[model samples]
Target: MHLFSRFQFRDWLLANDPALSRLRMASRVTLTILLVFLILLAIEAFILPLPTAAFGLGIVLSIEGGVAVRDKGNARQLVTRLFGCAVSLVVVAIAAGLEDQRVLSDLVFLVIILLASAGRVFGPRGFAIGMFAFTSYFMGAYFQPPLAELPEVAIGPVVSVLVGHMVRAVLLPDDWRRDLLRSLESVSGRINQILFKLAALAASGDIGEADRQELRQLEDRLKEVVLMAETFIPRPSAGVFDGASNPAAELAIRLFDAHLAAESAIVLSFQSPPPFALVHAVIGADAAELKRYEGMIEASKDQPQGETVRALLWLGEARRQLTEAINRGGACGFSGVDAAKDTAQAQAIDFSLANPLLRSALQITLASAIAMGFGLLLSRERWFWAVLASFLVFTNTNSRGDTAMKALSRSLGTVFGIAMGLVLATLISGEPDIAIPVMAICIFLAFYFLQVSYATMTFFISIVLCLVYGMTGVLTLDLLKLRIGETVIGAAAGTAVAFVVFPARTRGALDAALARWFQALRELLGAIGEGKSGFELIALSQKIDACYRDVTVAARPLGSSWSVVTRPGQIRQTLAIFLSCTYWARVLARSYEAPPADDDQRRLITADLALVDDAASRGSACFFIKRKASRTAGRHLPVSREGARVGLEMVGSALERLYPQADTLPFASGEAIARSKQG
Candidate 1:
C-alpha cells in the first residue's frame, strides 16, 4: 500500500510538473463527481422509489460520462439520452399492453435493440437513434406481464434516472466560463514563451537539433491550449438547467475564434527562417501587447467588448508577424540551418495512421450494447429492461475508444456491488432502517474510488446494487447470486455484440480522416491564393481543426496495448504536418493584403500562389497514395511560373523551393479565372 501510494504520487507529480493546471482540473472533476453522487443518493433514498432510483441513476451516469469525456458535445449527449429513455419506455409500454405473447414481445425487444444498435453504428448521429430504440425496448418489456403492476415497477426506475441526470447537471462544476478564461491566459503565456524562444534562436544563430525538437514540442502544446479555448463553453443559461433558457454563448465562442487566429499566426511566423534579431524585437514589442491584454481582461469585468477587443489586438499582432516574416526573409544574417531542421521535423510528423469514423462507431456501439445487454437480462420487466438498456447504449457515444475502461469498470462495479449487497442483506435482513445509511456510505465510497481505477468503480457499484435490491425485500443470498449472474451475462452479451456486429476498424477510420484533412488543405490553399476575407479563411481553418480533432479521437483507441497493429507515432506525425500547414495558411490569410500593381509584387503573388497549390495537391496525394507508383505519379504534378506578371519577384524564391516540380499545374485555368472574379 505504501509503495502504491508513492507510485501514484510520483505519477501525479510528473503529470503536474511545472504547472498544476491539469492537476487542478482533475481535482475539480473529482469534487464535482462526489457532489453529484451525494445528491443523487439522497434523491434515491428519500424522494424516489427503487425503480425510479434505477432510472435516475442511469441518467446521472450518462450526463457525468458525457462531461468527463473530451471533445464530446454535452448538450447533444443530454438530449440523446433523454430521448432514448423516453422512446424505449413508450415501446415497452406498447408491447406490454398488446399481449403476453413471448414471440411478439421478443420481436419488439429485438427490433428496438437493432434500431438502437444501428444508431450506435452511425457514430454521432446514433444518440437519437439509440435513444428511441432503448425507450421502446424497456417500455415494451415492462408492459408485457402482470399489467396491473407495470406502472409501479416502471415509474421508480424512470424517475430515479431522471433525478440522477438533474443532479449531475445542477451540481457538477461546469465552470466553462472560468475554464475558457484560464485556458486563454495559459495559451497566451505559452505563445509568448515560444516567440521568445524563436527570438533567442534567431539572435544566437545556434539552431541545434535539440532547439528544433523543443520548438516542435512547444508548437504541439500551443495547439492543444488553443484547441481547448476554441471548444470552451460558458456557464449554461438558467433555462438550460431546467431545459428552457437561452444564454448568449456567442461571445464565449468568438473568444475562441480570435485565439485560433492568433495561434495560427504564431505558427506561421515560425515556419521558415526569420531574422533572429527582428523576432527578438517583435518579442520586446509584445510585452506591451501582453500588458494591454491584461488590462483589457481587467476592464472586461463588467463588459464584453473589452474582451473582444483584447482578443482582436492579440490576433492583429500575430497577423503583423506573418506579414513581416513573409516580406523579410533571414535579414538577421542567420544561416538557414534551422530551416533544414524544420523540414526534417515536418517529415517526422506523419498522418497515415489517423482513424476517425471507425473508432467513433466502435466506441459508441460497444458502450451501448454493453449497457443494453445488462438492462435486458437483469430488469424485472422485459420491456422496461429493454428501455433501460437502450438508455445505457448511448451513454458513451461521444467518448473515444469505445470506453473500454468504463465498460470494464461498470461491469466489475456491478459484480462487486451485488456481492456486498448479498452480505448486507443477509446480515441486516431484520433492519431495513439501517440500509439507507449503509447505502449512502457505499455511494460515497464508490465515488471516492471512481477516479482510482476501474475496479474501484465496480466495487462502489456493487454496494449500490445491493442496497437497491435489498430495498425490495427480495434480499436473499441466492437472489444476490442470480442478480450478479444476470449482470455478468449482460456484460458478456454486450461485449460480444460489439465485437461481432459491424466491428469498427481503427485503420479504416484513420484512412478516412486523412482524406478529409487533405480535402480541407486543398480548400484552404484555394481560399488563401484568391485573397479571401478573414472570416471566410477563419471558417476554413476551423474546419481543418475539426478534422484534426477527429483524427486524434480515432487514433486514441489504439492505446498502448494495440501498439503492435497501430503505428501511433506515425499517425501523430501526419497530424502534426497537417496542423503545421493549417497554421501557415492562417498566417498567410491574415498577412494577405490586396496585391500591389507593381510587376514585382504581382509576380511574387503568382509564384507564391502556385507553390501553395502544389503543396496542397502533394499533401492530398500523399494521403491517398497506397503504392510507390501512385505516390511517385502524384508527386509529379506540374509546377510553373508561366504568366509573366510583375510584383512577383519577392515570392519567386520561396515558391520555387515550396514546389520543386516544373511541369503540371494542380488547379485548372478555369478555377483561376473564378478566383480572379472572386478577388
Candidate 2:
C-alpha cells in the first residue's frame, strides 16, 4: 500500500511538471553523444580528443535551443546547427591566432564577449549562436590549441551537429500536433485530479493544513500543465479570419477557462462553514463532465478538422458548466480573500531589450575583464572559470536585483558544489567505473533541474567538473578551493558592475511591469466596451495575461524570496491586487461574448463599461506617470447587468485591498459596486 501511494505521488509530480518533456530531451542529448561515440568505435574511426568531444557535446546540447526549434523543418534545423558549428570554429580560430600575444588576446576576447552577448538582438537562434561563440572562445583560451590543430578540432563539432540533426529529424522527430494533444490531455487529467481531491475534501468536511498545501501544489501543477499546453499549441495562423475564428485560439481559451474553473473551485473549497454538500456535488459533477470532455478530446486527436472544433466546443461547455456551478454555490459570497493564493510565474527572459542587450553586453564584458584579472592571480589555468561565471550572471537578467540574486545563487551553488565535489572526489578518486556513471547522473540531473532551479543545476554541473578532474588524475583540494574563490570573485564583480553601471532597480522594473499590466488591462477593457468578442478580444486577453505574468516575475525580488521587502504586507497586497485584477479582467473578457439582449441592457453595460474603462485608463496613467491616482472613494457606478455589476464589485474590492489603511488615492472608486436587480 505504501509503495502504491509512493508511485501515485510520483506520477502526480510528473503530471504537474514538464519533467517528462525535459527528461526526454536530456535523454536524447545524452544518447546522441553515446551513439556517436559508439558508431565511431564500431567503425574504428579516429576518436575526437577530449577538448573536441566537449565542444561537440556543447553544440549538440544548445544548437536548436531545446524544444523551441523542434517544430522547424529539417533544413532549418540543420542550418541552425551548422550556424552554431561555424560560429564556434571561427571563434576558436580567432582565439588561436591571438594566443601568442597575451595583451592583445585578452582585449580581443572581451570584444568577442560583447558581440556574443549582444547577438541576442536576433532572437533565440542568435542567443544559441552567441552561447556557442562564447564557449568556443573560452575553450580556445583555456586549451591554447595550435592553429595547425584547428582543422582536427573542427571535426568534433561537425560530427556532433550532424548526429544531433539525425536524432532530431529521424530518430525522434517532434510531431507538434501530437505533442499539443498530449499537453491538452495532461491539463485535463490534472484538473480532474484536483477536482477529485476537492470533492473528497468537501465530502469529508475537513480542510486541514496538509490538505491546503496539497491543494496549492495541485493548483501549481495544473498551472504548469496549462502553460505547457499553451506553448505546445501553435498560435492562430495569420489570415482573413479573426482570432476567435481560429480553432487553435479557441482551444487555448478553453485551457485557460478550465484553469480558472479549477482555481475557483479550490477557493470555494476553502471557504469557512462552506456549502460542503453543494461543493461536493458540484465538484463531483465537474469531474465527470471534465472526464467526458477529455474522452472526446482524445478521440478528436486522431480525427479530421471538424472533430477538433466539436471537441473544443465540448471543452468550453464543460468549463462553463463548472464555472456556473461555482457561481451558484456562492462564489462571490466568499469575499475572495483566500482566492489570491500565490501563483508561480514562469521565468521571464528580457528578450524585448533591443538596446538593453547591448548595454548588458558592455556590462558583462567589463565584469568579465575584472574577473579575469583577479582570477589569474588565483590560478592562471582556471581564470576562464571566473570569466564564465561573470558572463553568465548577466544572462537573462533585467534588473540589478536580478543580477545580484543570480550572482548570489551562483556563489552559493559553487560553495555547495565545492563541498560535495571534495567529498565525492575523495571517495571515488580511483574508480572510473563508478566515477563515469556518477558523472552521467550529474549531467542528467543538471538538465532535469536546469529550468527548475539554477542552483541545483549548477551543483550537478560542479559535481561533473569535479569527477572529470578526478578521472584526469588532477583532483586536489587546492584546485577545488581555487574554484570557489574564483567563482565568488566573478560573482561579486558581476553584481558590482550591475549596481554601478546603468543600474536597473527591481522596484523600477516592478513598477514598469505593473504599468504594462494595467495598460493591457485597459486595452482589454476597451475591447469589452466596444463589444469586440472574436480574435481581437482573445488577442487582448492574451496580452493581459502576459503582462500579469511579467508583473508576477518582476515582483519576485520584493517578495519573501530575497528578504528585500520592507513591508511584507504591502507586497502581499500588491500581488493580491495583481491576481484579483487579472482574474476579474479575464472573467469580464470571456463572459462578454454576446451582444446585450436589448437596448436597456446594452445601455447599462455600456455605461458600466465606460466607468471601468475610464478607471483602467486612470490606473494606467497613475502607474505610468508614478503619481498618486485621483481618489473616488465614495462614488458609484450603478449597474443592471450581472457581469457589469460583478466587475464593478471587483474593482471596489481591489481598491479596498490597495488602500486599506488611510484615505489614499486608488486605481478606482471603492464604492462603485452598486448592484441592482436586472431591469
Candidate 3:
C-alpha cells in the first residue's frame, strides 16, 4: 500500500482538529509561564528569599486554576479566582501545620483528594477551586515549608493570579462571538471554494478515485468546522446573543445545512457525472445570480434545464440562504423561533456513593493510597509521583475500560519517554543553557497537543521532568528507571482499583449512551412533527451530537478486537447502525421546513413518526436488556408534500433499517425477553 493511503493523513487531519481555542490558550499559558519565570528570576537573584521550585509550581498551578474557572464577566472571574486563592492559602497553612504529623497529614491529604475530586460535580468554578486546593496541599507536602516561609510561598500564587488575569484579559483577550462569526465567515469561503471545485469536477465528466478521496476529505473538513463552531455556541460569553434570536447560532445552523447541501451535490454529481454543458450552464447561472444580488452584473437570461439540475439546485438555494443571512445581519431569523435560552444547567453536588464522581473519587483515593505505599518502598522522595500518576489515570475516564486504556497509554508513553530522555540528557550533558530552552519547548508542545493526544502529552511531560532533573544535577540511569517503575506501579494500581472497586463496565456505559441518543432523537423527531421553532431544533440537534460523542467513547472498547465482550463484532455492527441513524437525524433536522398542508397527510406523517419513535424505544430497550431488536413496523414514511416529506422519508428509512441488523446481534430475541417478562 502507498504510504499516504496507509496513514490517511488527510482524514486524520480533518478528524483531530487543533481547534483555535486550544491553540490560543496554550500560547497564553506558555507566555504566562515565561514571563512569570523571568520576573521571579529577577526577584530571586537580587532581592528577598524565594524558593525556585516552590514558586514555579505554585505559579503554574495558580495560573491553571484561574484559567480553568469559567465565568461570563471579568469581574466575576476575578472574584472566583481570588476565592480559590483564599481556599488554597488556607489549605497550604493547614498542610504546613500538619507537616510534622505523618499519619495526620496522610489522612488530611486523602480527605482533600476525595473532596477535590468530588467538587468537580459542581461545575467549572468548583473544579477550579478543587484544583487549587489539591495543588496547594501537594506543594506544601513537597516543600515541607515551615510557618515562617508561608508568606513567601503565598506571594507566588498572588502574583500568578494577577499576571494570568492580565494575560487573559488584556494581552491576549478573546471575544467568542467575534471569533465564532469570523470562523463562520471562513467556513463560508471554504464552502464556496468546495462548490467551485465540485462544479469543475462535474464539468470534467470523469471523477477518479483521487477526486473522490479529496471530496471525502472536504466533507470531513466541513463537518469538523461545524463541530468547532458548536463548541463556541455553549460558552457563557455567547450570552451576547441571548434574547436577540441568537443570530450567530442561526448562522451556524444555516452554514451547516449549506454544507450538507454542498456535500449531497458532490456525492450525487460524482456518482453519475452530469453533462459537461449543463454543469457549465448551471455554474454560469449561479455566478450571474450572485453578481445580480451584488448589483455588479445583470441577471442571466439562459436557464439550466435537466433532472441533474435538481441535485445542484439545493446547493444554489443553500448558498442564497447563507448569503442573504450574512448580508442582512441575520434579519431573516427563524420567524417564530424565540431566541435560544442558555442551555447551561447547574449540577448540584452529588454526595451519594453511587454517583460516578463519588465513585471515581473513591477509586482514585484507593489507587493513590496503594501506589503511595508501593511507591515509598521504591523511592521515598518520589513517592508522590506515583500517587499523582494514579490520580491522573482517572482524570477523564467514565468506565473501567477507559481507565485501562489511559493507564496503558501512560505506561507506554513513559517507556518511550525514558529512551528519548536518556538520549537528550546525554546530548545536553548538564548544560543548563540548553536544557532550559528545551524544557520550555516541551512544556508548550505538551499543552498544545494536550487535547489532541494523551500519549504524546505524557511523553513530553516525561521529557520535561527528565530535563528538570538534569538541570538539578541529579540525572542518572537509576533515577530514570525508578521513574518508569513508579509509573507502572501507579498505573497498575489505578487499573486494578477501577476493575475491582465499584466498576463501571463499558458495555453498560454503551447501553446508557445509546439510550440517551435514542431519547434525543425521539425528542427531536417529536419537535419536528409539532412544527417547533428552529431554535428548539438546533438545541435538540446539539443534544443528539453530545449523545453521539458519548456513544462513540463508550463503544470504543467494543470496537477493539481485545475487548472482553463475547460478541465484539455484534456490538460493533450495532454501533455502526447507530451512527447511520445519527446521520439521518442530522439530515432530517437540516431538511425540515413545515408539516404537510393536508390534515390527513399530516396525520399520516405523524403516524409514521410515531412508528419512528416506537422503533427507537424498542431498539434502545433491547440494548438495555442485552436482547436482539426485532423487525420494525414499517419500511418508510408515507410520501407527502416535497417540503417535509424528504426529511420524513430519511428518518423513516433510518429507523426501519435499524431493526433487522439489531435483531442479528448475538443475544436472545426481543420476543424472548418480552415472554420472560410476561412470565
Candidate 4:
C-alpha cells in the first residue's frame, strides 16, 4: 500500500500497470509540456509569425508519441507513432474541407465518427489513432482557415508531434529499453537472493509461511516480468535497434527464458520440505556446480542423486544461463536464437468483416448519421460538437451497458468541464499577462491526466479550450452552453443506438469469459491427470490470467443491469469457488504428484478427477444459463495421499457446491423487462 511502491502503483492504474513506470510517464509528459510552453513563449517574444495556439496541437501529438517509446524498440515504435500522426493529419485536413458546406459538413462529421469508432475493431493502437483522428477533426474544423492558408495551418500541428517527442527524448534520455533491462536486472538479482534464501532454508530443514509467501510472490512477479518482456522485445532480425546491430534482442529473450526455467525450479524446490542432510549435500553440490558453470548453464550429463539436489541443479543451470546472457555483449558468443522462436512474433492485423464488428460498425455509423442530421437541423456550427460527442461515446463500447457508462461519463464530464471553463474564462477575462502561464498549467494537466481519470482529463480539456478561445477572441458563455447542449444530444443519440441496435448484456460477456476459463481449467486438469511436467503449467496460468482480465473488464459495466441479474454477492461467490479450485489445481499440477502403485489405482483416480473437471465445466455453464446440472458426474472421490487424488478432492469441493445453485438465478433481462413494464 506504499504510494510509491512500483508494484502497488501498477495495481492503481485503471488498466493494470506498474506504478513508478506511469508516474515517470506523467513526469515526462509534464516536462515536455513545460518545454513546449517555453519554446512558444520565446517564439512569441521574437514576434514569430507562426500561430502559437496552433502549435499546441502539434506539441501534444509529438509528446503523445513519447508515451509509447521503449528500450531497444526505437525504430518500429517511432514508425507507429508517426503513422498515427500522419493518419490524424489527413483526417483533420479532410474535416477542414468539409467545414464550408452546411449539409455536407454534417454528413462528413457523422462519417468521421463512424470510421473512428469502428477503428476499435483493430485493437488499442488503432483505437488511439481513431480517437486522435476524430478529435483532430474537431480541432481542424474549429480552426478552419481559408483554402489558401489551410496547408500552412496544417504544418504546425504536423510538426508539433515531432517537437513533443524531441523534447521527451532530450528530457528523458534513458529510454524504455534501458529502463526495462534495469527492471529485469533488478528482478534477476532478487531471484538470486531468493534462491540463496531457499538454499539456506533447505539447509536448516525448515520453511515458514513467510518464506513460502515470498517464493510465491517472486513466482508471480517473474510471470509478470516475462509477459512484460515479451511485449517490448522486437523479433529476430526485426532490427528494433539500429539495423544489423540488434545487440540486446537475443539477450532479452534469454533473460525471459532463463527466468522462466529458474522460476519453475524455485517453485519445485519449495513444494516439499527436504531433510537437513539432503539440503546440506545440495549446498555443497550447488557450490561445486557453480564453480564449474564458467558463466554458462551447460546442460550437464551428470545426474544429481536426490530430488532436492536435482531442483537445485536446475536452478544453478538457469542462473548460469541468465548470467551468460546478461554478460554477453554485442554479437557475442551466446546465441539467444532459441529464445526468439519461443516469443510469438507479431502478425499482420486483420479485422475481418465479421459480426459484432460489422454490427458495431453499422450501429455507430447509423447512429452518428442520425445525430448529425439532428444537430444540423438545430445549428450547423454546433453540429460538430454533437458528432464529436457521438464519436467519443461509442468509440470502444462493447455492450449497451458500456455505451451507457461512457455516455453518462462523457456528458457529465463535459458539463462539469464547461462550468469550470466558464469560471476560468471569467477570471482571466482581462488578464492577458497571466493567461499564457495559466494556459501552460492547464496544458500540462490535460496531458498528465490523459489516462488516469477520464472525468478529470475532460475538465482540464475544457479549461484548455476556454483559454485558447480567449486568446482567439472567441470565448463566450453562450457558446459554452451551446457545446453542453450539443454534447447532451449526442450522448442521448449514442446511448439510444447502443441499447436499440445491439443490446448486449454484461452478464452474457461474463458468462463467455467464464466459459473460456472453464475450458482452460479442463485442459489443465487433464494435463495434471496425465502427469505433464509442471514447467508447462505456465502456459495454463497465462490462459487463466487472460480470462480473469476479461472478467474484470466485463464486470466494470455490469452496474447498468446487475440488479436484474442474480443477488449482489452470488456471482462473486461463484467466482471465488472457481478461483480457489483453479489455484489448487495449479498447485497440484506443479507438485511432483507421485503416480499410483497400480494401473487400477491410476485409472480409478483419473476417472474421479475427470468427473470433477466435467462437473466444474458443466456447472459453470449451467450457472450462467440458469439451468440445473443434468448429469450428476462426481461421487465421493476415493481419499488418497497420492497428489492427484488429493488434488481432485480439493477441486471437487467447489464444483459440488456450485451444481446445487446452478438453477437458482435467471437471466436479468427477463426480470428487468418485467420491472420496467410495471414501472
lDDT digits (tens) for residues 618-652 of candidate 3: 64443333334322222221111242444444455
Strongest candidate by lDDT: 3
lDDT over C-alpha atoms for residue 536 of model 2: 65
Q: By TM-score, how accurate is candidate 1?
A: 0.50
Going through the candidates in order, what is the number of backbone clashes in each? 67, 2, 0, 7
Candidate 1, residues 2-74: lDDT per residue as tens digits?
9999976654443222233444433434444444555556756887643442344344434334333232344
Would you list the C-alpha lDDT of every candidate in the order shown?
0.47, 0.63, 0.66, 0.56
> Which residue runs does candidate 3 get wrong by more than 4 Å?
1-19, 185-221, 231-250, 266-309, 316-348, 531-539, 560-576, 595-643, 661-679
Q: What would the per-residue lDDT of candidate 4 be over residues 615-640, giving only the tens digit for each residue?
A: 64553353343333222112211111
Candidate 1 residues lying further than 4 Å off, grouped into runs, are 1-88, 91-107, 117-129, 132-146, 157-221, 231-504, 557-568, 596-679
Instruction: Return model 2's CA RMSD, one decimal.
Output: 10.3
**Compared with the true structure, what per-residue lDDT tens digits does model 2 show for residues 1-679?**
9999997775565574543676667666666666665554543346544454344444444423453333246787787778888988898888888888977888888998988888776666667777777877888888787888887667656666778878877886765554555566566568767757865775676877557657755765676676676665455343112444444445555666687666545543454312343334344455564455555544534333223223233334555543443343233332321121224344555654446877788899999999989998998789888998999899778899889888988888888977898789889989988987887777777777766677887898788888878888887888888889999999999999999987888877877786687677667656665667655665576666677677767767654442233222445445545555565565556556656334443444444444444454444232222223222222221111354445544544563444343445344432332232222
Q: Lowest summed-lDDT stretch of 10 residues in model 1?
A: 630-639
Give the better candidate number (2 or 3) by TM-score: 3
